[model samples]
Target: MKEHPEGGTAAALLADPRIRRRLPTAGTALGAGLAVWLLGGWRLGLTVAVLVVIGDVVRRSRKTSSVTAWQKSSAAERRTEKQLKSLQRNGYVVLHARAVPRDDDGVSDGRIDHLVIGPSGVYAIDSEKWDKRLPVRTMSHLKLFHGPFNKKDRLDEARWEAQQASSILAARCGFEVPVQPSVAIYGPSIPWKVMRVRDVDVYAGNRARAYLRRRPKILTEGDVERIFEAAQQALPPKYPD
Candidate 1:
């Protein structure tokens, strides 16, 4: 049975400080409607009130979606970071928003969402937030389907990011650093705990911590520290503040 009431999402939204501040007060639409009624007919006044309410709702939705969606994609990373906190005490070191040159052009394509180094070896995890309404399923081990959209490009990108990190870390650390590529999907129900699809690991976001822990510990503590330090220097912060 669910621990909380069924309207938990609605309750959480009502409680969020950011969303609460944006909630329309009682006077807005009513005041506007009254003003219109004084100037025009009741029909016009009703129309004006409806438009005002709709505008307010649309504005709030836009702001919230932008903050939580791809325009501000860091929300997924932050979620995964909290989930991985227990790993710290277990000798795991995590790097967030790390950037490295994608190629000889020296331009950074984008930042890796998370880089994890510790006993389970090095991992480059790409945290994703997809629409919950859409069903995520794989057709064959080679193809991933999100509704009707194929995620071949996304899988390829994840692999490339891991390979890039592996190359840089190996060159800097003077040893082979095989960084495993993985994706932790949020906002949708992933059918599997962990699966290797198109050479990259995929799993539900809730399994982020367990996903890494389930792997055998291949590196000693000393090796972990050296690579963690090297990764810090090699993969500079994408958004240095």
Candidate 2:
């Protein structure tokens, strides 16, 4: 199993120039507020100080939310990657954070959380770190609801991503590569061991490995290599050398 480097989304967000710019602006506001509080009249100074503090608080809140989301996503990716590692001894090739093009124009839609190629077939896995506070409820027509948020479309998106991966591999290998879409729900209180919605597998974090392991073998050793090669060629490198 070839291990592709992780830290794609989190690293990109951290290295973003916009974040660097915001830090200095926030610092300037904090310093100016302190100066006003020390030299100006108490009433006016207090007002300015309070306003600045509120602004800073809001800014920090947004930043913290982004960081927290990234942390959760990174953690989920690591957990799933660890589980997938056990498959290497069984002739599975795993690729992490593989970018799949969603359009014919060559623009990437998003990166597949994990791509697994083995004797069973190809899989395009999407790892989700959903809030565990709210229980996921399935309504009519397999509609999913978490808290107040409707998550039914997530399965559709994952299926589209898998189809895109299959198309890419098929074009490269001259044969249809059936890519199965799976959503590994981490940090969620899922009711079922494995839930299938629109043919997409939705399973809890702990059961991801077992769910994948249960897949029937469909490809040979040579087929795995061929599809893996095609994947490497089609997807972008997770990290730059």
Candidate 3:
């Protein structure tokens, strides 16, 4: 197995606030301009440019809030990485914002913030960086605080992504591949909770990696490799060609 880099580097890159904000916005603007020029006229291109600038400005204003969220998600991922490293010190993979299998919506919906598929089993982790205590319940649907408002839908989306991916794998491989969805909160403000729903485990910032490591084995070495290859092919590039 190839050796993997330290979790700190991946975490730092993941935590880097600019990639998510600046690079994508720039790329989108460029793409829009190119499309407008090729198919439409200068007027359409100019309009796109104007919208791009406006979008950038709006994003700049929201950078602080976005950065805060990024930090939390990265923390949980790094925690999960620590355990994955133990299982296979090297060759353990961590893919961030990987789109769900077979996405045609055009929008990158239901991203697996941190996906670790190793000798143990496949883990679909959702990182939540929010303030306030989350109440633990046996039921999956529950409201959690979100600043001035309460947002329960934040982490549910991740779980749904995991489910969809699991179904895709099962159909492709002719076996029920278990995709364990876990919620890892990364913030001092949010209180801890331990809950289970439809086999998905809900946990807080603390012990997230440990929790993932404890999951039952669903794929062997070969099976893991096959799934990883499939996911790699399905993953969208961070940068454009």
Candidate 4:
């Protein structure tokens, strides 16, 4: 097994050990403050230096290094998987990185991050790790906007994935199976407990277990077993190569 991770972008500015270490970070702030002092005033420069120091402290507290999008997503999945462990103990079945056919969805690459089925019926969950600097909010419960980016396409993709799962399970189980679509986001705080936007449930990634627990439990033990069997066969492991 590999000890180190993969796919991390090395920022040119952040490559220097001087910039990363506390003493050097303080030195850089002092330099900046000195430059500001010449242009503006001493008080203004002091304030700017203090702000820079505080900002660097906060950044180091949050993360030590820069990571690519894939790295962030992989981390988010791991965090969510940890949350799903309790669910597994409670008779729930969780499938990670299952392949769901595009079926002309036009939105996804045929991937369901986590498919959970238990007492709350079925769920197709997509894990997301967005920038914490941006605020996450829903517009009238019909749209989700993260900073300036609209998440309509993502919502649609999740819904389509769940719909495809529902179709496959229904065909094999010989009954209608409704799979709830959801997006479990990490990093940025999700302001709402559970919000339905464009037919997809959205919540914080850490709330994975709690979210299911709060849902209306309608599936019996037998139903969970049968559906789990069907899904295991129908949706192959995405990483099975």
Query: Which candidate leads in TM-score?
Result: 4
Off by over 4 Å in 3: 1-86, 90-92, 101-108, 132-150, 189-193, 197-199, 237-241
TM-score of each: 0.68, 0.66, 0.53, 0.69
38-93 per-residue lDDT for model 1 (tens digits)? 99988898889888888887654434321233334456777787777779988898
Q: Which runs of model 4 end up more than 4 angstroms from their true locations? A: 1-73, 103-105
Per-prediction CA RMSD (Å): 13.0, 12.9, 16.7, 10.6
How do all the candidates rank in terms of lDDT, highest first?
4, 1, 2, 3
Model 4, 136-226: lDDT tens per residue?
A: 9988989899999999998999998999899999998999999999999999988888899999999998887788886677989999999
Please state the error at residue 153 of candidate 3 in Å.
0.7
Clashes of 4: 0
Question: In order, what lDDT does every prediction score?
Answer: 0.82, 0.77, 0.62, 0.84
Candidate 2: pairs in clash? none
Q: How many pairs of residues collide in model 1?
A: 0
| Cα lDDT for residue 76, candidate 2 | 74
Q: Which candidate is the best by lDDT?
A: 4
